[model samples]
Target: MAGPLLDIEGLNVDFLTDQGWVTVVRDVSLSVAPGETVGLVGESGSGKTITSLSVMRLVPDPPGRITGGSIRFDGRDLLTLPERAMRQVRGNDIAMVFQESMTSLNPAFTIGDQIAEAVRHHLGLGRRAAVDRAVEVLDLVGIPAPRDRVDHYPHEFSGGMRQRAAIAMALACEPRLLIADEPTTALDVTVQAQVLELLRSLQQRLGMAMLFITHNLGVVADVCDRVSVMYAGQVVEVADVVDLFEAPAHPYTEGLLRSMPQLGVRGEPLATIPGNPPLPWAMPEGCRFHPRCPYATDACRSGAPALTERGGGHFSRCLRLAEIELTGAV
Candidate 1:
């Protein structure tokens, strides 16, 4: 609804390994506008989390590093900011709700303490004001009796309640952008639906940008305004929610859509991509998904295609996107 809030270009992340510095995220680019939600969909080890971490300058330094890229948040280049300045921006201007809320919260602290601590640190609120703000935020996120539950420890809360608390903490600072990495991965169906709806409502109310990372396509369709399909370490396709589901532009996106059980014939096993993603250190020579692509040809096997727009904001990185007749066969 508003102007662009975050813009990332040519993001390259690498990890130092026995094989040398292996590229993890390659030339990755994405953007999120104010009050909009963008989904980054990919399987495990596809560098989705790494790409988000890089935006926050949270990449582990010794073994992992951001080799190149320009992360622009609110038109300011984050990569160029000094550590102290970046620390001030992180949490104050942008927040993240990482996967595995159980592990993300400190077992020793109360939900209120954690959330209030963020407000205290980032917004310079007094102890009482921070605690009051925490209660307000908890209630804002649909937490019942926030005043009573404020003293509950992480272990005392249910899985869904703890996740709500995690979101409450992330929103404590009223950040302009929220990066949620697989926040609903471990929830049950009911809770997952609740969380998704909660996210949509919160975004609408607060007018904050959200970059949601997940491997679930269903979630993307339900909550994302736009979606990007990531494979190996690069984005293969990006399109509006309706456009992507109607007709995915890349072979990998097609395979993923066909693999969903909802689209499969009754009583038949769900379709699946044939192979695991290539190791970042041992990536194939050309298109990363060529080995698994059903319509891969010589061009696909020998030369990777750069991302190109097809029209109406749809983009794909397949050399034969136009040439092949991909029918989404399971």
Candidate 2:
């Protein structure tokens, strides 16, 4: 209905290495609408994190740079924004919650102080007002005794509590877009579920658009409205969550779904995708995923397929979209 809150088109990122400048993210495109959650699912080194980092203009230059494409957020091109303007956009309009809470938080500072800094910077609140704002946000995130907990350092909190603190800091400015990079990866199963539920509730309460980056399809199923599957350096498929789970169109998407460990099959070996993802410096010609694609044909090795529509907003990149009937995760 409404236009995408954040739209990325033809995004290309390169990294300088001993060999040369090799593209790590190529012609990638995706979007997130207001109040919607979109999952970017892929294995390590698939360029998922790179894409998100580029959005915040936090990509480490020299070693990493976004060479092409545009990141349009709420009608403005973020890539072209001046640094001072971008800084305002970073923690205020757009915020990121990294996977590791310990790394994201500062052990030296009190959790309240850390959150208060962002509120003071973005909202331009005075010290007392900022601390009060921090307590309110901590309470919003379901942390107990927010007034007292705010004075505690990072080490004083447990893993899950630290994560909640990280989230509180991100939401302190009430950002329009929240980029969460595997926020639940380090937690146990029960904690993971709690965190996921927390994120869902917060998103609904705040009405913020979320770009959830994770390799876990199960999390995608529970939290994301739409899913984008990335491999090598390209997006191979995009679909609605229910449609993707019921009828995945691409071989790569099918492989990922089939590889998910099913609950009742305890004795059987877990299905796996053969061969590792190719290195960015030495990517294969044509379709980047052809090497690991079970249904790849000669055409697949000759030229990369553009993402083509498979009806009802489901798009897939494959030479055999018609001939193949891929299995679904459900």
- Which one wins on TM-score? 2
TM for every model, in the order presented, reads 0.97, 0.98
Q: How far is candidate 1 from the true structure (C-alpha RMSD, Å)?
A: 1.6
Off by over 4 Å in 1: 1-3, 328-330
Minimum summed lDDT over a 10-residue window in model 1 is located at 321-330
State the lDDT of candidate 2 residue by residue for 190-218, as single tens digits: 98999999999999999999999999999
Clashing pairs in 1: none
What are the lDDT figures for the candidates, one per model? 0.91, 0.94
How does model 1 fare in lDDT? 0.91
Per-candidate clashes, comma-separated: 0, 0
